[model samples]
Target: MSSEEQDPDYRFTLANERTFLAWIRTALALIAGGIAVVQFVPEFGIPGTRHGLSIVLTAGGGVLAALAVRRWQRVQAAMRRNEELPATRVPMLLGGGIFVVTLIVLVILVIWPPVGQ
Candidate 1:
């Protein structure tokens, strides 16, 4: 019998699916934030900093979005085959990206407050 033919628990499969959906949601939110930042945020401190943040966040979102799908597939396959799931690095990457973006925004706000607030 093929690996896929080996039936896994229904609950596990459903849980995996839910996790995948959650990741997609995260990606969408990040993309929206990026758009809002670039389009709505006023030009602050450095001229290009605003654009740079938007770009970095959007790119990070894109990377995570792709990895989310891939990770789902990978984990699903491992589950089906009854094999140990591989280590995941996505969480680290995602967290680091968020931290870096937050730092940049904080620095910008501190260094040069947006006037007329």
Candidate 2:
């Protein structure tokens, strides 16, 4: 076999691995955040908002994680063939958007609670 074909570094497999790990970490953080919000924050009488926020956060994290895994695989395949990396800005934008929206929702929940009868 040729040197380039034998040398793994000739491709971007390492980059793909790093990207996959990053997504996993991001997913874990999101899961933790959701659990904390739902399980712990409620102890302080913030249960109502926390519960809803937890669901949203958890789902968001899951979606991000799934997307990340798929993207990683696609990128890895592209790299192996010496093709350009696929556009990833959309996922980044979506993830960011979810995070910002969640933050805003949490803030609103904290500042103006629901009408508690």
Candidate with maximal TM-score: 1
lDDT of each: 0.84, 0.71
**Cand. 2 Cα-lDDT:** 0.71
TM-score of each: 0.89, 0.72
lDDT of 1 by residue, 1-117 (tens): 583556679999999899999998999888888889889998877778778888877887788799999999898888888988878988888888789878878988998866454
Residue 37 alpha-carbon offset, candidate 1, angstroms: 0.4
Residue 65, model 2: lDDT of 89
Query: For candidate 1, which ten residues in a row score worst on lDDT?
Result: 1-10
Off by over 4 Å in 2: 1-11, 43-47, 113-117
